[model samples]
Target: MSYRRKHTAQTFITNALALLFIFLFIYAGLSKLIGMSVFKDQLSQVPLTTQAAPFLAWAIPTVEVLVVVLLLWPSLRRWGFFSFLGLMLVFTGYLIYTLYFSPYTPCSCGGVISGLSWRSHILFNLFFIGLAVLAILLVPSKSLEKQQ
Candidate 1:
């Protein structure tokens, strides 16, 4: 295809990925915040996070919302993709640890995501992680856009 068509396609894919992450983060964050008690209890049950449950119970949702804000702004969208990728990697790593190393795996994931099995959750995170990587690659820097 032509340069313009390719650019348009890339822009569309990037925007779609951003919207998906925005929705995921906002919904999951709100769900956790709304069910703070349950979330904290779940976190506390995890051997690794028991001591930090109270702080992390609040921090996780706050960071999720912050990421949504970053993703919403054009200039900061790249950072948002990076942040999304980082968070996904961390979460997936923790999932792997819980699945293999930990005898008891307590999931503190909020909303519909909490319903997924440990293995399924890892796959879900991997899918989003792939999308985040794609978005980062497809999103043109401001300088590049200006040149184009």
Candidate 2:
């Protein structure tokens, strides 16, 4: 393939991934905010987060919304991908810890995602993590675009 075609393909993939992340964050953030009481209760049930449940209940959705804002801005899209990857890694790591190490596992996820089993949630996060990595790789730097 030609340079132009390859660049176009990469751009398309990156944009698609951004859109997906935006949707995921928006949905999750809104879901948690809307059901604040339930979400907080769920978080409180998690032994590790029981003490910080209240603060995290608010902070998590706020960060998700912030990430959505980053993803929407063209200039900040690369940072958005990095942010998404970092969040996914943290979430997946927590899930792994809860699944294998912790004696108690509680689902604090919002929306339909709350229904997913722990193993399924890990897989879901892994899939998004992989996409986040691909988006980071495919997103062209502003300098590169300027030179082109």
Candidate 3:
């Protein structure tokens, strides 16, 4: 393929991936924001989460919404990608922590996906993070250098 064709294909893929991430994040975030009881119910299934459940119940969804907003903008897409990756890393850490230190199995996340083992949760977030990273890398930088 010519350079232009390759660039177009990459851009299409990146935009599609971003849209998918944005949709899922926004939906999940709205679900959390709309129903605290549902979130609390899900939290009860996880052990350590019970302690910090309230804060996370409110915070996670809010952050996800913000990340989606940022990712949708051209100027802010890089920041969004970085923020998303960071959040996913934190999520991975939480899953790992729950798996090893907490006594209870992780609860269903947001009542959307059910019965995800801690390992599965980590891998899922890792996969999304990887996709976000790839999308960020594919985005064209604004600056250009003139040949000497």
The residue pairs in collision within model 2 are none
| C-alpha TM-score for every candidate | 0.94, 0.93, 0.80
Question: For model 3, how does the per-residue alpha-carbon lDDT over 1-148 read when each residue is reduced to its tens digit?
Answer: 9977887897798688778788878877776777777777667667777787778787788899899998899688778778877887887787787778877764546545445666777788888888878987877666621221
Model 2: lDDT of residue 137: 89
Show pairs that collide, candidate 3: none
Candidate 3 residue runs with Cα over 4 Å from true position? 41-51, 144-148
lDDT computed for candidate 1: 0.91
- Name the candidate, 2 or 3, with the larger TM-score value: 2
Tens-place lDDT per residue, model 1, 3-119, is 999999998998999999999999989999999999899878777778999999999999999999999997899999999899889889988987888767887788789899999
Q: Candidate 3: minimum summed lDDT over ten consecutive residues — where?
A: 139-148
TM-score of 1: 0.94
Which one wins on TM-score? 1
Clashes of each: 0, 0, 0
Per-residue error for 143 in candidate 3, Å, reads 2.4
RMSD of 2: 1.3
